[model samples]
Target: MGSSPSTLERHGYTVVRELGQAVLVNSKDGDQCVIKKINLREETGKGSGNTDVCDAVETLLGLSHPHIVKHKTAFADDEYMYIVSEYCSGGDLYQKIKEQSEKREAFSEEQILDWILKICMALKYLHDLNVQHGDLQPKNIFFTEYGMIRLGEFGEFNERARQAGSTKDGALSYISPEILDGKTHDEKSDIWALGCVLYELCMLKSAFSAESTVKLIPKILNGSYPPLPHNISHNLQQLIEETLQTDPGKRPLAGEIIWKPFVLSFLTARSEKSIDELNDNLVKLRALADGLEKVHYGATVGSLTGGVIGAAGGITSIVGLILAPFTLGASLIVTGVGVGVAVAGGATAGISNITNMVNQSTDRKNIRSIILEFQEKMNSVVICLQHITEGMEELKHQISLKNEQQSPSGGTIVKVGTRVSRGLGAVPELVRLLQVANMGKVAAQAARAVRVAEVATGVFSAFFVALDVFFIAMDAKEIHNIRTTKASEADDMKSKLVLQSPEATDSDSGADQEPKSETMKFVKKIRETADELQMSLDELKEIISFIPKLPDIDA
Candidate 1:
């Protein structure tokens, strides 16, 4: 229950309509908005509860994105908290889908593609900021008067109110199986919900429709949805299958989904450009695709290098002795370096391979065939890159945890830094390769590939910078400890001298105290170094964060 229209008028708004617990309110200036009343007193046995809801809403209010519904303002009374958001007169997507269902019609492939693409773009924007929509379904997707979709009904209210097992009979069909199983979720959970919505739109029916939640739970958990109609495009079918995966980690990210060939094809077709323009666009598209394949191959080779270097049996006795004291730190940093070098070297090799392959035939037909062969290798490369990136991230996490527990030794720092430096030395090679790719005729075929190469260069450069900072931090930490120990020793010497010679002059005492003053100076310098290291580490993390957004051809 919420305040009446008359009560809302006191807050400078007049209620136009009651939409469930929300009221469509018109401001004095004729601006319209929807105000939803959230009762913080409502208790939920799961999640972080009302406090989290309040915090979430506060966060959502600060966010202003074109694809996300605007939360204009909020107010509270004794019984309820009110959230005001921009009004979308075209209503929600669910209403549109229901009207189509009533007419016994399903959305065409093109229409579904367009809708999903917009949704994916919105999701990508949210996921990049580590924000989960939590509840994603057709009903939560509102349409503006211009027919653009804006994601709404989010923030803390949905988090605390919505549950897979519910008495209110909510949209359980669109709930991810992981959530139903009482597991915590992330961005991938939204993807699963998106798949359910996509399936429903294409078929004009719920993917797991049931009379009760009991029936629906098992269908979702078992991934037992009805088969797509034979007329559905194979690409769309594959996308749905991937998104509906039982394992959340296996689900493609929203950014990856946006670049799917089916979505790209739909975008190209929707452009309605002339044949010549289309051909030019296709060349750029092909280049992007090729770049992704090369990145994948590079990642694969890098992973192999890491595996070999990390393996106990693979290390030479001499090298092992050099790394023995710093195994954990050196291995992680070296592996990352290997990955960067392999990635760069792989790009150069791929360019050479392509050039050789293309040179054998001057015919356009032969060039096209070679490009096709390259595209065919992309799937394997993508999988390999995923594994490599995941492994490297896991290693970095482990190293960070270890560092938190105990400060590393000076020997370890020097060794790790040396190895990373060697790896980083490959940067010049990467730069040269990038320069060649930029200037070559190959750039004409895959304009995006050059950009990908630039990204790779930036990534490797960031990695080297991060490693350098880590080494400095570790060195500073070690120096700080050494100064502490030396200062302690100096005090002991001074005490011994005082006891041995009670008649020592004030000048002698001052001379002894000079060493202590110098030690304090070292301590101050060490603190400054530590501060610098932290700043560098923060910068490094910012750089690493960009890795996920890199142009993924396979996406």
Candidate 2:
């Protein structure tokens, strides 16, 4: 359905070469791109009624992630449609795998883990937004000149494959058992494909294969695959086994496996500072929140004390102005200044309490509002500090003016002078404490952002810890041969079922249910432990639930 090569050259692109169905091209501006030509009618054929490839292409153009190859644009001319995307120079991983196979060499564990993590990262990104890379084979994976891998050939290509019928040689090797049983693919299906990819990386061969599709179907449905090499680590073996479970319900999610202890340990050893920082920030937040609560209480108490002292002084000064003739001018000024400070401090404290209540009740869904509220609280503290400073300065000035006018004083005036001096000195210390509280507010907001990221990834720290525990259990001698244990259990169950009457067994709905495997039972226990740990963490979080609100004199 494609037109002449000259027709595409007229569209400001010069074809450098052809790579399969795609042409490597360079724009007049020196931009390198790959344009894949597809015939819409041919791919869909008659009565398929599937024309959503255009919409999928549009979606691809909107996606932009480091691990995903960028789709620049798409255009159609008559019967043929073309998609333009950024070209990767290092070719697809399928070629690399084939090369390594020829040499009879397996990839290093580090390199394999690195690629797995990258692929999962991209998958998690898409799955978070309810998007799926339906065709996620090594042939669709690409690498840059600098050796950074990226996931390409997604979106529309997957839709096209479904319409065209997936009949490519060796393609059935990666198809999950559920798909063979007439079930549609989902996120779990991607995990199954990932398992196959991992197996190839380790064994340098397909996980399942046969002379033809007929024989291959039974091998996949039976879930019988060659064991991993003895050199492979138990953790990686367990991961591969879990992902390739014939029952999708038993499969670990992409989010779960991404944070598996093996993957996490690898990332930690590599010192991925960005991930390290997320964890570090969470720890800092907990400590800062504790310190912030103490400072908040201290500030509240200080504001109350300042208010009380100021009110008492204002009342005493008014009485002094009425009774003492010589101190009339000074006492009048002190009365006005004392009343102003008392009102500002007390009102600020009251408003702060109200704001804290409102913030505590706020739903985290409105994260923008919460951040803005914290910022507003910081600003209010700055304003309150200014007001208190101004009031203190006015009081000090009036006291000095009164002393200059008067020659001598009794112990009563001496006591009053001492109290004023103490209050003035405390202002700087309170300002420092308020400033620290502001820092705590900032830390709390950052911690909230980290929480958002964790949620988006659909993983929890406790879950990872639980995975570690499960892996450690797997290292036990009894648990080492997990597949053997599973086979023995299956045999025992089958023998017990054979003893029952055939008619009764056939009619029983529960007969179709496979016995709960040992692996799944152990996993259920680990999940329970994770739930317990998460609950405990939730309790700890409640201890620092209240974000300290600063007093606002302006309010």
lDDT of 1 by residue, 1-555 (tens): 247565578778987877764678888645678887765566434445567667777877976454678788877676556788888877898898999999998788778976786677678778877888877888889976545568887634664434334332356777888888898868889999999988988887788887777787899999899999778877678788888998887677775665442343344334222223323323443333333233222322222222222222122221233333322222211232222233321222222232232222122222232222222222112222232233233323333443444565512333222221222223444223323332223213233333333343443344334333433343344334434544565555444433442112112454335322222333233333334333333332332333332111222
Tally clashing residue pairs in candidate 1. 3
- Candidate 2 residue pairs that clash: none
Candidate that scores best on lDDT: 2
TM-score of each: 0.48, 0.48
lDDT of model 2, residue 485: 37
lDDT of 1: 0.52
Instruction: Candidate 1: list runs displaced more than 4 Å.
Output: 4-7, 42-51, 159-168, 268-555
For model 2, residues 1-555, the per-residue Cα lDDT tens digits are 235687677778888887765789987655568887666777566544336667677788888665788888887776667878987877888999999999988899888977877787678778777787877778888986445578987634744633244344456888888988998888888888888888888888888988888998999998889988788987678778888889887777665665332343354333233333333333432332232232223222333233232222223332343323322122222322223234642322332332232232111112122222222222222222222232333344434544454655522344333322323233444333333444444345434533433342343334344334433442332223333534555555355444643223222456344314222333343334334434433432332332222222110
In model 1, state the lDDT of residue 487. 55
- lDDT at 282 for candidate 1? 36
Which regions in candidate 2 have their CA more than 4 angstroms from the true location? Answer: 42-51, 155-167, 271-555
lDDT of 1 at 296: 26
